[model samples]
Target: MEEQRAPGQWWRYGPPWSRYGPPWRGGPDEAEPQHGNRRPWRSTALLTAFVLIGSNFAAHDQPHRVPLDPYARVLLLITSLLLLWRHRYPVPVAFGTATLTLGYLAAGYPYGPVFLVVAVACYSAVVAGHRRAAWASMGLLWTGHALVALWLYRWLPPAGDTRAGLTQEIVIATWVLAIVALSELARVRREQWARERADRAQAARRRADEERLRIARELHDVLAHSISVINVQAGMGLALLDSDPEQARAALTTIKAASKEALGEVRQVLDTLRASGAAPRTPAPGLDRLPELVEQAAAAGLTVEVEGEQPPLPPGADLAAFRIVQEALTNVVRHSGSRHARVVFAHDGDALRLRIDDDGPATGADAGGSGNGLAGMRERAAALGGTIEAGPRPDGGFRVLAVLPSRLKEDQ
Candidate 1:
């Protein structure tokens, strides 16, 4: 059977209403409000005192009404005390206070700060999102008062009280409507603040994920290229050690230089991991470092032939282009049987184009090379609205072509 919602219960939301069927309980989520439950003692005490004293003054001013007696004072105190648990039991308290307020009216006690307790209870209920309950309780009080003042006053205490005026009833209704409007406004502002805080948290997580991916790609490219060069030099050093000691010494020197450069670049990358906000010790490498790439490829026994003028690119595009070239050359050194490779740069309208190719008969994982390096290359280019295309040529060779926007940073 579907569980039925309580009459005047709030819409299902927050922690309180979730288990109660429908979004219909008025409990203020999981934890009680800071100002509530923790210390209702002080405020309720003050409210009780005010109602008692203010009703005394009102009795003196309205001598036609019943005098302030022990019963009337205790009745007002009980009405205020209901608010002590208003946060946990908003519906019950709303009804409790409003009903007691009507009883005080039936006794013909002079109105004073006695109504303040009713207002506070209704306020708490409406803010807790039990709007229907608050309205029902308040309606009960007003309707009961109208009955006594208009028809039943002839039989009640303190004789000769005239029938209540319609204007007076209208005035009371206007104030209640105003309080409900203000409560509705407060609820909307609270929900909006919660949504904004959630959005900011999600955005923070997205940026963190992007930063990690960038660091991973940097480490992959740096280690792959440097290790390939070191491996080649180590092999040559071992082969020539006895027969050609001088050539072996040259190979060792090349190995030392390559290791030192790799260490510096690795240190640069680690610095960011250690101290996130610190400025990098060295600026990022760009297309201007093509000579270093050629040298590294040469150390690995591959000859790189260059052609065409390289166009200037945005900082992001520049770094991506340099990494693409570096990864392509590293792949050639590792998997291509060809000792010769060609790099060509071209200008196409507002874009800078790069093409790297090697003459290849066949080598497993050559050019198409597992797509890890290729995927990294594609990610970099796509971040700046660029593209990377790499594959084995139809005639029998490998090719990597990239087209990047020259003014991407300015446009962004």
Candidate 2:
């Protein structure tokens, strides 16, 4: 029975790329939080310029704050440069930017876009799966700023500065909340992209595996049946080559026809692999070709007698039914001592019943029996939500009975 996928697990089993495999894009997995060797030079430079020029304008309005000296400008440069390593060392950059911004405030520098650097670093950290680190860094920076604004004003530069107001504190707290919320949003988005990619990769693998198994079943049925006939006819031709040339010629003709038909079917299967997403040149073999199967069995010295009227079936069930019958007769020819076989068909409501039996005391011929014949038949039946029972009958014969749904599940 096919296992059902659990809820929330999307098994796309996607398109033609299923032939080879998915195009796997490699990068840092969960074990490593780093973005792997990304160069943040351009963005770092832009942030540095924004902070420096923006701080000069901000310093104009803050009458009690210190002016932008060479040391203050140097500190701002260092803070922005730290952002370049955010993708490679997100935790360090997050903490380092927060610490530097806190120091800049303590030194009485004007409040401007310095927090922008901290925000970028923390955002990178959170998106890299280091949420705790980013939260801690932002928390510490906010705490230190609160301390300086409420109590540490006396010890700071640009003297005569008074303590900040309660309203200002509320505004600062809200600003910090907004920054953290934005970072969390970005982190969630990144995680979602990763999950979707993983889903696609899994889908590709499953589709490829299914396609391989299906092709294997087709090739097995085609080659096994045709090769069994060729083996028998070749043996006969060899024995009659000198004694009777006309009979030998007839055997060779059967061999030639059987091999040509087999090659055409094999090529049809191969074409699916060579050119995916194209329609097949020839329709797949089904019960419409049952006469050919019976004739081939006759050429191989086995007589197949049909007992019931063929029933109408959907495409999938029809193909499976043909392969099952073909494999059963092939087995009879290769392994059974009896030259006579009976194929009976009956319809039981929505299901079609197939029974193939050979009147035999077992030949036990191990030669050329791949041992996968019964297994293949069983798989074909099970695929269409059906059952197969193939075992030695109590009455000294081999019986293979298959119950297949007339309509496939997909068709319904």
Candidate 3:
């Protein structure tokens, strides 16, 4: 269920119907209506202007060979006044105006611009999405106008002036139809714009989700690899504490180095979260740091041989490739029984290829049936429009290979 907002709380953010709000509240949905409680002064002002203009015309020129009387003038004023609440109660206002218009027409007075009020009311109804009510009111208005025109032509008009009355009726009918058509077109355009906004909002949310997933994968790879090395070193240190003091001291040193590196990387991740707009304190770990990663793996009893020629890569692809290598080596150290591994990096025109082969058992965790490390590597590769292949080699070893595009299409 959707959460209900507190009463009067919207005023603190902005007007009740305004889009602006506190950052925590989330943005308003463009597809939803924004009907504020405050009086619609603009509509009131326009109606006031129309009433003044209509009154001036009623006082001077007579329409339909009939002069305006006090009763007809009162009805015209009442119809215009009803429009002040058109936005709040569009159907009621429209009905009220239509009733007053018919009364004015039937009173044997001039057609003193009562149709202007009815037209405005009809437009308000349509804008408020009350299409059926607007159409019904329009029908009632046209029917009333036609009946009044026929009555005038038959009884009130001079015999030779019948053609003039008919022409007046035709003009009024055209005006009413034009107003209805324009209002309907406006409603359709508004609906189309709202739909387009909704689609764009959905697409933005999907992109944000993908970006968050990518960042999570990077954090996972960094933590897993560093912790694995620390765990291994700490275990060796504890085992050699009494029997071989020097060996134990050396293990403790490795543990300290690994923990320090882990802390720095963790700080980098935290910085990324805290200050997205600020420059990073340290650049993301990329191909340049591959040697340090290998050294760390070596200290954890994994003899890793590095072979690669560095090539220029987009920042995203560079970081992803480095993470892929880090995750693969970490898996070898944690799951593979063998201690020797070889990492080969090669550039192939538009793509950067990575191959990590380990002389480990064919059937092991690192052989890549299903593990988070392998999954993370695959995600990184695929995000950069690349692919990963991991399985047990035929010669009783495990191999992980990744090929990443040096420049992503989005980057281009």
Candidate 4:
């Protein structure tokens, strides 16, 4: 006994019984499948040509056979028309057209090119990922053909010869097998291409996310350091405006310089985003600008002292070291209450080490406090296989120490 399929399983295994609802509708959790760039008109034109050719062949080849009645001709036309919707509902269309072709054949209509519609419909089902439906339809079609051949051999005098009948069946079977093989091969190739396209899209998205993170880090380092300096200088200028005109004028000059530098750095970042083919811009700030940074800190009422001999560092290490010092000093100016800060840079064998300490009262900045500056500094150091430690110093103020390889392994 054949097992009966459930209602929901019928749509998966066989053709839909009705076509009243929207063609693309699905359940809330299921998305309707999209057939991109499919040209239904091409299939329609091909099938229409097959119908005409088959009709003419039948008329010429079977002159003694009775002509197809109006109803049989109409059924053939309807089967051909169903090809128009094959791509949208491939399984249903294949089954429907095959059944209609069987009906026309059983009505004793003269043999014609009606099998072309079945072949094309089976191919469409396979391409749409309905392999089970394609195979089932092909089985039914082959069985029907075998039954028709057997009946013709038993009833008709000329087709009754067993040798001729077997030869014809063999030829028909070979043609059907060839069509199924070619369609399955085409379906496999299409699936492989789709997988490759999806993989490429996923990789591109990952690269975009990484680039966004890098740009964010650059912006944070630039703006945080500059804004801290400007804030300190502006506050100093306001305080000394009535007390001492000379010091207030110097403070205003420092604020202007800090703001100008900040604007230039910001413009460089924006230019990189806007113009891909633009000429090379200025190189990033490094330890060479340490003295200017120290001067700016001094002008901001923080007494900063620098000690050590700078070594020839890799470009990545140089930039990392500069940003580390800049962020450390910026925190001192903005968060720490003490005004005295010390920066020490040293090349210890294979590693370059930097330590920035300030004798300021611990103002919660040492406890991983309220910003991304400390996190940014740590990230810069770690990117070059380095480490950074920032916290409150025992019996004193906050301290930051970063160690990095003087030369990267890749450069070596």
Off by over 4 Å in 2: 1-36, 366-369, 408-412
**Candidate 1, which segments miss by more than 4 Å at Cα?**
1-39, 231-252, 272-278, 335-338, 359-372, 408-412
lDDT of 3 at 355: 94
* lDDT at position 50, candidate 3: 74
TM-score of candidate 1 to 2 decimals? 0.79
lDDT of 2 by residue, 44-110 (tens): 8788999999999999998678998999999999999898779879999999999999999999989
Best by TM-score: 2
Q: Candidate 3 — which pairs collide?
A: none
lDDT against the true structure, per candidate, is 0.84, 0.88, 0.78, 0.79
lDDT of 4 at 408: 64
Taking the tens digit of each residue's C-alpha lDDT, what string does model 3 give over 80-100? 877767877999998888877
Instruction: Judge candidate 2 against the unseen true structure and give its global Cα lDDT, from 0 to 1.
Output: 0.88
Tens-digit lDDT string for candidate 1 (97-182): 99999999899989788788888888888888899999898889888988988899999977888888999888878867776777
Ranking by lDDT: 2, 1, 4, 3
Candidate RMSDs in Å, in order, are: 8.9, 10.9, 7.6, 9.2
| Local lDDT at 93 for model 4 | 86
